[model samples]
Target: MPNVTIYTTMMCPYCFRAKKLLTQKGVKFDEIDVGTDPGLRREMTTRSNGGQTVPQIFIGKRHVGGCDELFALEARGELDAALQAA
Candidate 1:
């Protein structure tokens, strides 16, 4: 399984939706609550290439952007392959 991580705020609806989608897809992830951790938030920003938004997602160290980007990947039939690849 890929090492998935998601940086999120407690009250972000997109964050919730992103997590829900990942769960529904049976994708296990490490969730970091950046709203409560400034250091992690800073790290997430760096990881996301300066995307200072909630729900910065990664799959095995590959920056995957946020909710809309995730959905876009799914729409393009790329998400599954990405998840399954080494």
Candidate 2:
């Protein structure tokens, strides 16, 4: 499995949903709480190419976007492959 990193805020439902999906898939992810840190938020924005939202997810080095995009990948049957990628 590849390294999964998710930038999340404490109270975001989308973030919780995204994490639940990943957990269901048996994927261990690095969760970064950016709720109180402006620097971390800035880092997330820079990494995501200006995505200023909760649950900015990355599988390995590839950006998988937010909760909706993550579910879209699952619906498309590409999420497993992405997770398994090197």
Candidate 3:
């Protein structure tokens, strides 16, 4: 599996949902809590190309946007392939 990362805040429901899905799929992800750190939040924005929202996800070097996009990938049956990609 490719390296997975998710930038999130503690109170974000979307973050929780996104994480739940990943856990269900047996994906191990690096969770960065950007709720209290401006520097980390800025990093997330830069990494996500101005996506200033919680749960900005990355599978390897590919920016997968937020929770909606993640779920959308699963709906299309492409998420597993993406995760398994090198």
Candidate 4:
């Protein structure tokens, strides 16, 4: 399994949905709560290339954007390939 990291915040429905999808895919991820951490939030934003959203997800070292983008990948049948890619 590849390394999965998700920068999220509490009370964000999109974050919950993103995590749910990952869970359903049997993927373990490192969740970083940026609810109260300014520095971490900045980090997430920088990592996401100006994406200041609640759920900035990274599969290994690849930035996968937010919930909609993630589901889009799944819909296109590209999410599994991304998850399994080296």
Mind giving the per-residue lDDT tens digits that candidate 3 earns over 11-46? 999999999999999999999999999999999999
The residue pairs that clash in candidate 3, if any, are none
Q: Candidate 2 residues 1-86, lDDT tens each? A: 89999999999999999999999999999999999999999999999999999899999999989999999999999999999998
Tens digit of lDDT per residue, candidate 1, span 2-40? 889999999999999999989999999999998987898
Order of all candidates by TM-score, from best down to worst?
3, 2, 4, 1
Q: Pick the candidate with the highest lDDT.
A: 3
Among these predicted structures, which one has the highest TM-score?
A: 3
Candidate 1 wrongly placed segments (more than 4 Å): none
TM-score of 3: 0.99
Clashes of each: 0, 0, 0, 0
Give the distance in Å from residue 62's predicted Cα in candidate 1 to where it truly belongs.
1.0
Which residue ranges in model 2 land beyond 4 Å of their true spot?
A: none
**How many Å off is the CA of 67 in candidate 4?**
0.4
Model 3 whole-model lDDT (C-alpha atoms)? 0.98
Q: After superposition, how far is residue 37 of candidate 3 from its true place, in Å?
A: 0.3
Ranking by lDDT: 3, 2, 4, 1
By TM-score, the better pick of 1 and 4 is 4
Model 3 misplacement above 4 A? none
Lowest summed lDDT across 10 adjacent residues in model 3 is found at 46-55
